[model samples]
Target: MNTISSALWPWLALAGLGAFHGLNPAMGWLFVAALGLHRRSRGLVLMALVPIALGHALAVGAVLLAVIVFGTVVDATFLGRGAGIILIVWAMTHLLTGHRTPLRIGMQTGLAGLALWSFMMASAHGAGFMLIPALLSLCVTPGTGVELAASPSVPISFAALAVHTGAMMAVIGGVSLIVYDQGLAFLRRGWINLDILWSLALAGGGIFLLAG
Candidate 1:
C-alpha cells in the first residue's frame, strides 16, 4: 500500500547510508579486517568488529541528537568544519607516528575497550559528520528525500545504527574470509600493501575535508 511504502522510505535511506559507510576504508572496518588477518582467527576478527561498530554508532547517534535538539540554532557548517579539523589532527598524528597494527579481537576488548575503540575510531574519522547532512536533508524534505533522512520515525535512529553496524560487520567478515582463504602469498608479493593504502586514504580524506 502507499502508506506502507511511504513509511519504509527513511529506513531504506538509512540502509543505503549504511552501505555507503561500508564502502569507506577509513570507517575502521578495514583495520578490523587487517587485525583479523593478522591473527588468522575469523572469530577473533569478527569479535573486534563489534566494538568498532558500536563506537561508530555512538558517535553518529550523539551527532544526531545534537542536530535534533539544536536544529533551529546550530550552524551545521561550523560544526562540520570543526569536525574536519579534528579529523585532520588525528590523521596527522597517525601519519607522524606511523600506522601500528590493531590488536586482534578477543577477550581483550571488554566493555571499556569496546567503548574506547568505538569512540576513538568514530571521532577520529568524523564518521558522525557524514550522517548530519544526510539526516538534515531527509528531515527537511518529504518523499524520497524525507525517507532518506529519517524513517521508522524517531526509532529510525536506532535503525540507522543497526544498518551501519551490520553493514560494516558484513564487509569486514567478507574481507577477512577472502584474505584467510587466499593466504599471504599474493598479499606479500603484491606491490600494494592494503594496510598502508588504507592508512594513507584515511589521511587523505582527513586532509581533503580540512582543506575544503
Candidate 2:
C-alpha cells in the first residue's frame, strides 16, 4: 500500500497542477473567452482550444525533453534543487508583481496567433516548470540511453503529460463555456481570486522538490 501510494501521488500531483493551471485565467481560458466574445461565436471558442492546447503541450513537451536529456548527464539531486529554487523565485516574482503579465496578444489574434500566445504565456508563467517535481518523481534517477528508454518511467512520463494536459483542457473548456453562456458579469460580481493560492502552490512545489 505504501508503495502504491508513493507511485500514485506523482500522477495525482500532475493532474492537480494541471487543474490549477487550467483554473488560472492567465493560462489561456480568459484570453480565449475574450476572443470568443469579440467574434460572437461559441464555435470559435471551442475551436480555439485545439491550438491553445497544442501550444501548451509543445511548451511542456520541450521542458520534459530537456529534463530527460539532462537526466542522463546531470545528477538528479542537482537538477531537483535547481528546479526547486527556480520555482520558488518564479513564485516570488509572480506574487510580488501580482500576476500582471505584460502579454498583449489580444483578442484579434487568429488560431496561429492564439497558439503562439498560449505558448508564450505558458512559458512565461513557468507552467511546465511546475511539473518538474512530479515529473522527476516518476523518472529513474540519472538514467542513461537504452536503460532509461527500457524503463516504464519513459512511457509513464508521456502518460503524465497527456493526463496533465487533458485535465487542463477539461477545466479550460468548462469554464470557458460557462463564461460564454453567462457573460463576464459573474466574475466581477463575486469571484474568489486564486492568484495568491497559485503562488503559494508554486512555492510549496519548490519546497517539495528541494526536500525530496
Best by TM-score: 2
RMSD of each: 7.0, 2.9
TM values, all candidates: 0.57, 0.90
Q: How many steric clashes does model 2 contain?
A: 0
Please write out the lDDT profile of model 2 over residues 141-209, one tens digit for every residue: 433222233256567778888999999999999988888888998689766778888888889889988
lDDT assessment of candidate 1: 0.56
How does model 2 score by TM-score? Answer: 0.90
Regions of model 1 farther than 4 Å from truth: 1-13, 72-115, 142-153, 184-212
Candidate 1, residue 123: the lDDT equals: 64
**Whole-structure CA lDDT of model 2:** 0.82
